[model samples]
Target: MSKKNSESDSANGVRLDKWLWAARFYKTRGLAKDAIEGGKVDYNGAKGKPSRMVELGALIGLRQGYDDKVVEVLGLNDQRRPATEAQALYQETPESIAARERKAADRKANNGALVSEHRPSKKERRQIHRFKSDVFSGESL
Candidate 1:
């Protein structure tokens, strides 16, 4: 009824940082605000501010760990909600999903090829020298 509409559509939207936190993009409003201030978030393809008002169907680009996500705002909420409800507030774009999956697959494929460039420690160098000397000494088994 009228009461419900008033509660849900009071402002028709909420602050970007609050929405980000409510949508579970960030665990807390502080984190969301920090991300916005740090240039880690975009609103409608432009840099976002913590107080920016979020509108439906707006594209938001944010970085989460090693993945960059582009999500379309589906709904607006200011209060943090459960994970399931939060997820319903936005939808990741298909291209973003595909990119994240491809990156994951590429990471998995290259996991075993890691190369270390650090010089051996003194202890490790000593061990290697001992092994080389033993091999050169030709000690019988």
Candidate 2:
């Protein structure tokens, strides 16, 4: 028979990055580390390193490429889980749900993308060249 223990009594608490990876939220530990370092992950409204420990009931925020996920820490483990099973580790808040919806609306109205200061991609450079070629050529307007 398996015995159940309280959350605090069990050795379930772990580093934030570990929990994220185990929960299948991120593919690798490095990805989790980068996210934490870039301030894309927060615990209890405070930015912290990837090695930060997470306790039960702590509020966690995850900002991925185009979405922000908020969850309450329910449990922690050292093993990764399937996409579906991993999702059950945390409970999503209503506020985060609303925030994500609003962000989606804003993004659609603003060119269907979130404008970033990052450098242009190679495709963008090619488009720029093509546009300039046609506009700067000796063609009639």
Candidate 3:
């Protein structure tokens, strides 16, 4: 490939929010921007702006819901791609991967203990509603 074609193929860098959206970390660029502005994303261990340029080898810390992920940028792309391709953009650190798995397992175990086989019956629902009303109204029963 010619030098010009290579340069076109790999641009200088991509915006942080754009990279997050392209990597499938967020459903849309707006969501990614919100997260960045909300302090849910850190670049190189410090808070970053949505418009910050993301280049190869940069460390990114992303908090999505209850999980935190620390990944090193491996590639840069502004356009959203398939899951497999998106995954290639960054590599999660081993410690982050292990921590996430442990947290997931703990959550699963805690939730499993409270799992019910069936939904509540009409009587149960009514009782729950009545109890909530009593509590809110400062009633004894």
The number of the candidate with the highest lDDT is 3
Per-residue accuracy of model 1 over 32-94 as CA lDDT, tens digit each: 999999999999999999988899999999998889999999988887779999999999999
Ranking by TM-score: 1, 3, 2
In order of appearance, the predictions have TM-scores of 0.75, 0.68, 0.73
Task: For residue 10, give model 1's deviation from the true position in Å.
Answer: 4.9
What's model 1's TM-score?
0.75
Give the runs in model 2 whose Cα sits over 4 Å from its true position.
1-12, 112-141
Candidates 2 and 3 compared by lDDT, better number? 3
TM-score of 2: 0.68
> Higher lDDT: candidate 1 or 3?
3
Tell me the whole-model lDDT of each prediction, alpha carbons only: 0.89, 0.82, 0.91
Give one clash count per candidate, in the order shown: 0, 0, 0
**Candidate 3: Cα lDDT at 69:** 96
- Which pairs of residues clash in candidate 2, taking residues 3 or more apart in a chain or in different chains? none
List candidate 1 stretches off by more than 4 Å.
Answer: 1-10, 115-141
Best by TM-score: 1
